[model samples]
Target: MCREPYPGRVTAPVFVLTPETVEPAGAAATAVAGDRLVLTGPEAHHAVAVRRLHPGERVDLVDGAGLRLVCEVTETAADGGRRERLAVRVVERVEEPQAGLQLVLVQALAKGGRDEQAVETATEVGADLVVPWMADRCVSVWRGVKAARGRQRWGAAAREAAKQARRARIPEVAELLTTAELAGWVRRVNDAGGLVLVLHEEATVPIGGVALPDTASSEAIDHPADEPRGGGKGPQDPVTIAVVVGPEGGISAAEVGALEQAGARTVRLGPHVLRTASAGPVALAVLAQRVGLWG
Candidate 1:
């Protein structure tokens, strides 16, 4: 009943809805042909009033859970509250396939919200998850209540960025972690048959040739029950690409050693040192292509 995003129109407009608005996650939300999908509230207002999406135009609704409902605007009308809305007819529904390679970025917190900016770009570039790493060289600090707020801020940025990029899935933003915790993540990724790469300016190895784990993930995609990721061994698990980016002051030698010791491959992004805000996303773009996700 559902398929992937329409193969032809990559530029089709996409809008996000609350999890409760989608079925399986919530109640009575799945759509079918002839179903009237009343897109209202702020999202509809943005479409009808600001973006001027007229009747008969096509649009897509994604629930961030891989469900993409493709619909056509049937008519334009106003809600009881006087805001404009579009009455859409469900043409088809599709479930987007999960990314072949899970790209996770561990970014060291930087001053002036540079870290948050990095998450925004990373989400746009298809990072499945992100972690805020509080490294020794980081100028910013997150403690107690501040730590919770920081995580919330990063999550919000990811949501907005994913929406702007018209992605069907939004990347996750994890808790702020210490150096020791980062090492633990590397070990977990390694054990799960994933690749963990650290971005170090001084490293001699380039990210280009750092061979990823294996091609097992491509086969796992066809059989969801086969445990495509996590707590799996050999060809059954999906490969994870975790990139660690340091702050403005750069990573401490000790921190780098800790991560490397935990099975992270230290690779340089390029000849020039990149800003803490730009490094992780740039590395992800390179890895995405290398892994054939961009193809």
Candidate 2:
């Protein structure tokens, strides 16, 4: 006979949701409804076998889309010879959107496995996008199957971390890029409404001093005496921001020059030297704070 709720007995509910199931529904719009959600794939397995959740039992269901659903298990199917099924009925749902500052971390690939840590931290800190930059100083080489596997692993980490943080949007992990490729990406993102900021200790200006180009500035209307004049629409829309970080050995002078030539403004995080893996997320958190993302 079991004594009344044995001392130190495990009571906190174990999750049935895993990275595989969570990733698909994480960003999908149709995966969840108000106070109701459906679980499939590995999530279904965890619910049935690992947790042994039964009908009428309450549980929390979090979709990586920033919706947290408090639900009750309404049906359960568990048999030794057959697959299991678990159904949940949502009791409540909460939705929280990402902050106004759409920060993207263009992180240089680092030696060892630090890139993964960077990805995980960026996801937790609410980075809207993570681009793996293969700078000249980057020591870890990624190609073909290794690159694919690494990306999958990073995606899984991001999904799990997003769920843990209860974020509404899953940050994207872009395919790896070389220095030249990264510059082109910067140009594309700039055209898409982002201001490019490259983090370099050599920069004299702090990020706080860098503001979006004001539409009303006289420069918007005045034609430079040295340039050919052409009619144009009003000042370009507010540029979105992309923050770039360097590798373990830090960015080279030539690479920095390239980024600057590509229209990226260099800014410093502070006086202390932060590892390549730490700088991107630190900058992101600062940007998030500046834009009132932190509650």
Candidate models: Cα lDDT each:
0.77, 0.64
Query: Model 2, range 139-231, lDDT digits (tens) per residue?
Result: 887888988887787787777666555453566677888899888776665555557789988899887777753222211122222221111
lDDT of 1 by residue, 1-295 (tens): 1122356755768777664433234421567666776765666776777778888889888776566778888887765464766677878877666645578989999999999999999999888789889999888999999999999999989987887877777777777889999898788888777888999989999999788866543531432422434324655355678899999999899998999898899999998888989999999999878766666
TM-scores for candidates 1 onward, in order: 0.86, 0.72
RMSD of 1: 3.8
Q: RMSD, each candidate, Å?
A: 3.8, 11.1
Instruction: Give the backbone clash total of model 2.
Output: 7
User: In each prediction, how many residue pairs overlap at the backbone (N, C-alpha, C within less than 3 A)?
Assistant: 0, 7
Name the TM-score of candidate 2.
0.72
